[model samples]
Structure formats: C-alpha cells, structure tokens
Target: MVSPSPELALHGLVLLGTDTVYAVHMPTFTAPHDFQAVLRVTLDTDTYRTARKRYGTSALFTARPRTLLLKDLQPGATCPADLYFGRFGRDGEPLGEVSITIEETVYVGHPAAEPRTLRYVLFGREQLYLSHVLTRPPDFDQVVTAQLAGEWWASGSGAETPARTVTVPDRPDDLTGRLRPGEQLTADGTQLQVLAEVYLETADLAAGGV
Candidate 1:
C-alpha cells in the first residue's frame, strides 16, 4: 500500500562461503492479513549460469540476477567476494540496489565446520544478517512453496527485525528446514517460518510471483 522510503537501508543474510546473498526486504502484503517475507537469495548471472552448467538447468529459473544455489563450494571457505542485492518488484519491475562492501565471519563450534555463519555489513552497520553455508549444494527439491507476504519494499532504517528464512537441509537440528502451517524455526536469534495461508495482491495487477 505504501512505497518504501528512499532512506531505508536494505538488510538481509548472505550464505557464508558462497556468492548467494539473501536480501531481506520489507514484509510483503498477504491475504487475511499481512505476513513476513522469506529470505530472498540472489546470485549474479555468471555465477547462476555456472551452476546451471554444473548442476543442470532443469531445477533453475531464469532472472536477470538469479536467485538460489552455488556450485563446487566447500563449507567454511570465504565467499568469492562481496555480493549485491538488485531489488525487483513482484511484476519484475526495477526497484534499487545495495552492495555488501564489508563482511565479518563468525564461527559457532569449530572454526572449520560446515554451515558456518557470517554477517554482511556496511560501515560497521549490519547490511546482511547471519546466514549459513550448506554442507553440499542445495537440491532443487529444497525449494518449497510457502505462504509469504506479497511484494518487496525497502526496510526503512531501524533495528533489524526477526523475519522468516527458508529451510536449508543438512545443517543442525534446528536448521533442518521444516515447517507445518503454523510451526516456526529460530536460528542464530533469527525467527523463520511459514505463515498460515495467503496470496500475493500483485497477482491482481501483473504477471509472475517474484
């Protein structure tokens, strides 16, 4: 209903050790009531194309800056480099972009462990939240349709809020990524889950769900 303020900063999570970056946009509009959005992971075209060539294109979808999966990466390894989130609308309209110039990596148990965590920041302020490194390349079957608030908007400046995150398999018990209609998953102080049920309002306007 309202446009995001230009002053708002983009905040989200980056899958540590990979080119995958999850830009946590503001909540989207849902049916009965608005619900939280999911961790929207995006990848550069070259990186995405490489994954398609290595892992097969059957599971992937086409987008300018693609989303999902990184190939031949090992856990705990430093990411290729800082990444950017090129914002887009549900109708595939252009929004704005933000880049993660600085990053700080943190480890839980051992310094060298699968699914390690990292934070993406800019000027000491967190631009990205804590995210994990998958033990192996994520399977396309990992993608699941869940209820989310529709549309992407800027996260107006403020403290980072807890939001929903997609389930990544082969991690810790909590990271196992499973959700019933009402269950929730909490990781690294981040709350994630599937909302009951809702539809994107933009479907009434344009094409594609985004």
Candidate 2:
C-alpha cells in the first residue's frame, strides 16, 4: 500500500514591481487550530482581494512590500507615490525580514453578513460634486456641510465633494436624519434632489450608478 503524501512546507517569493503586494497569515475564524495564509495579489498591480489557504503544521514563508503607492490615492487625484521593498539584486543582498505565526488559541465567532450602506452622491453641471453616506443620526447641535473639497477631471464623471452651503428642509429647525431619497437639498445655490441610484454615462467613469 502507498503511504499518504507528506505535507510540505510553504515557500514563496514576493517580487518587486510585480502584483504580489501584501501577504498575511492568521487563524481561521471557525477553527482556531487550523491557520490560514492570505496573499493580497492584484491584477493591475493594485492592492485588492486576498488569496487564502489553510496550512496545518508546516513552515510557511511570506513577504510583503514595506510601502504602498495607492495608500492615499483617490478617484481623481494624485498622491505622493513612493515604494520601499528593501535591497535587491546580487548575491548576499538582504531582501527584507518577515516572521508570521499565530499565538492565540481563541476562535472568534464568524461575522454576520450585514448589508452595505448606500451613499448619496451629488454632482454639479461640470465635474464638481458632493456626497453623503450618513449611517447614524446627527446630534442636536450638529450641522452638516458639503465636507471636504477636491477636483474631478472628467466632463460629466464623478468628482470629490467640495465645501458648500448644504441644507435640508427646515434648516436648523429640522434634524439631518429627516433627509431621505427624492428629498431636495440646496447645495451652493443649486437644487439637487437625492435619488436611489444616479448613473453618469462616460468612458472615464463606470456606467453603473455611482
């Protein structure tokens, strides 16, 4: 009879200028004894989802970049892009040092599947914009504005919200919790009514509602 294949130790290489961006190893939520390793690999070299696997009782190697370029990136803005992944090339060069191991023995319960909260995005005639995704009601003395200010390039695409005078019905007399879909709000002398899903058709932005 043939013996079962021996479980092998995990080994990997995280190359720079490649898609393998981040790597992590942690215990599975359901079974604390079994550990899961995750690798945050991106298609366009952008940080996104993770590649997870269960490796029981085996040595594993993981490496991730020291710095990321898209940490502060926005939809239509440029951020200081700097990358640091330690020394490379030639023999005897140090690539970096990484050690990942699970020490905890507790198994946290699986998280509940909560629905996503939809955001209310408001845009102007050109590329100007404002948006709100209020999950909780504001306090009695709280006053809401258009939030931060930024610019968007596309002619009719989405943009960041700029500072402006935004008010709902009854002004200070009414609370911001009263704001609902189809309700109109005056934003910088412009009347913009909130809707469920607002879609802007353009090649620069996605055709789906923003």
What clash count goes with each model? 3, 0
Clashing pairs in 1: 12-129, 28-150, 29-150
Per-residue lDDT tens digits for candidate 2, residues 46-146, read 32112211211111222333322222111231212112132122122332343322222111111122332322323232222332322222211111112
lDDT of prediction 1 = 0.26
Q: What TM-score does candidate 2 get on C-alpha atoms? A: 0.23
N/CA/C clash count, model 2:
0
Q: For every model shown, what is its TM-score relative to the native structure? A: 0.23, 0.23
Which residue pairs clash in candidate 2? none
List per-candidate RMSD values in Å: 17.3, 20.6
